[model samples]
Target: MTASLVLAGFGFGSVAAQEDATTPRATLRIVHGISGGPEVDVLLNGEVLAEAVPFGTVSEFMPVAPGDYVIQVVPTGQPAEAAIVQADLTVEGARSYIVVALGTPDAPEGRVYEVNLDEMTTGMARGRFINAAPDAGGLDLVVAGGEPLFGDVGYGDASDYIDLPPGTSSLDLRGDDDQVVSPIADVTIEESLAYEMVAVGQVADGSLTMLTLSTAVDPSCSAALGLGGAIEDACVRLTHVAPDSADVDVHVNDVVVAEGLTFATVTEFVMLPSGEAQIFSVTAAGSPIEEALITTDLGLDPGQAYEVLVTGDTEDLQLAITGIDLRPVPAGQARLGVIHASPDAGPVNIRLSDGTAVVEGLDFRGVSEYKAIDEGTYELQLSPAGDDQSVLLTSELQVTASIVYDIVVVGRPESQTLAIVVLTAPVPVQAEAIASPVASPGATPVDASGG
Candidate 1:
């Protein structure tokens, strides 16, 4: 009975009241899609339900005693006391459960995906997309070269399941503007199975990405439904690390990549033609540039990233180039990545609402996974990584749809230096929601997470 976070509607009801109408039987299939995480074990009321369940694993539906069982998802080989996610599930005898283990080790949670097969046409595959990317905006899941499947699937929003012909298809995730953000190729759907396409991970960092889980139809079907970081180019990131620097302009081969760079300013990952030598220039901010303050050469490599930073005093300005193996974002939606560029601030953690840690262990030159939140108002709270009470800054941002941004933390602490430099560009907007041919469950409370 360790402390656990309660999920939406993970509430209580008398087991006897639920069993009054039918026999005591419950069946469930577990879908695992946690990225940059370890294999997990599932336990029901302290009993092992499944073991060594790896990432992207879909378990066969297994029958369980229908009652008030506390469901827990623990890392494989770990004791039950270390469960990462747990829930109280009381299911009726005639019904089944599709328990999805989503989020990352950083934000793991158990979600139940429920489907009514009778509402779907016979002998067809039922599918939908659930936006569990935490920070991603509206998303669309479409079959490659085919019509759109789900559109404008917002945060915590689940599209009504649509029935598709069973076969192999290339699945791509696009932003609301319809540009392919995630190129998940070659997914095969079998006959009479229900599939849940989960969009996970950050667009900037390639972990916790998109994956589909197909569960069979029927109470006992196959146990019911079961469930790469390869960088091609060397992404380049720029930052201003000088603690007391003024707003400055940065250039690469005469191209103004960043402008008005105050202290601790950072740029989003810029795709560079890797394996070449490039020169970087720093000068005072504004168009009619004065003499460059500092110029340096960067010999970057393919399949890697280099951070070109400007640091030191006004009298002795300097350049520091550091090589890193980092991931980049794809096209489609606007990506908002972060960086720890404040040299005065040793290391810090960033959180959304001071609850979920978006970035941690972030020192100067550290980059955070691009968080893909919707185009709306969001308040980001900054605190020293582990301490809860010592809040550093509270920033409220206004983000628009389809625009990618690089939110840089700039300024020094002594002057209470804190401000944001947002670098923005528009991405493709997806088409509006295409009506699903399959009938939706009427008036029922839709659990967007499928549970």
Candidate 2:
């Protein structure tokens, strides 16, 4: 199957931000708060501090010498002379600060806020509010249905740190004459922790929003050590491979999880409740859930991910469920998996176009173990087991380092529609266990099925 590289779980890479406790330097964090802004690079004193930072991103705190410095924001990969916004700020030793790039891309603005990192009174949490919304003038942050917490905060300005009772509290942003501008709900304020809330976006277009940035309370900083990207909840993606089926909707527990999924297309991973039986159904687009063409009950485990393949013809749709491993592959290697989903193409063998056998006797509904292979391009050929005279499918696969490619053999040979569909995922820090048959050359095969 010929496939394009699909980038998943993309985010800014963390620059090394930890400094020795004895270092006489101030910590600085750059935040991308500009509405609809391009990916940018943050420069401190003419040097790049963070690279390729996208909107709504808050960087890890990096230590810098306490003194006056020039800050610049430029489009990522651009020259230093192309900075769209520039400002001068001074920071004190042993203190923390945040620089927010706000407003539109054409007319960017910056706001600086001094953060309180000092120890707080027991049972109380602290928060600093910054008004980054260029159009929301004179905002008052108040407890929802209660009193004001920070009053008359102007645009590009910050309010004094306010002590809040520990627990979840909702707040409202009020404008002139105490008119409610926006209601932010379910804010968690844990005791002994500090937070910064920045009001951003344009108020005239109803895009005014707040970003709550929290600081780690423990020195371990486990929450900051790339653990936030781990998959703690179970997720499943649905791929419509039934060649003759109409556009369909996937329903999980009577709720539509994916709508109008066309043939050979896959949906983004949908989060689902795990550790219990889930009722799954498929119906024609715009059809009621009761009119399901197929229904199945399955239980998924937490901390794992899955792919549900809908194969076969419209008259007899089949579901092939397979768990996928997302853990990172060994350095310089690529992971490969194969699934035999074509009902008409009975047990088949796979080999390189140059005559190197890779898999043998893989039957319908069979899924192969992910094999570690050297990253490169390969021409793959498949045919009936031990019969090289009849080549059923051949395609070129380009494998990149640290990527996982799962190829699904699909379509009906009788209708001359046989082909393959390739799905890919990036290497992640999380690992999951799954069972499937088939393997690369020299590896033992496992006895498993995807149906």
- Top candidate, metric lDDT: 2
Highest TM-score: which candidate?
2
User: Which residues of candidate 2, in runs, are more than 4 Å off?
Assistant: 1-232, 429-451
* Candidate 1 stretches greater than 4 Å from native: 1-24, 218-451
Error of 1 at 295 (Å): 98
- The CA root-mean-square deviation of candidate 2, after full C-alpha superposition on the true structure, stands at 18.0
Q: Please give the TM-score that candidate 2 achieves against the real structure.
A: 0.45
lDDT of 1 by residue, 344-416 (tens): 6668877667365567778766777665444456677777767857888888877664455566666666678
Per-model C-alpha lDDT, please?
0.60, 0.69
Backbone clash pairs in model 1 (N, Cα, C under 3 Å; residues 3+ apart or in different chains), count: 20
Per-residue lDDT value at 388 in model 1:
54
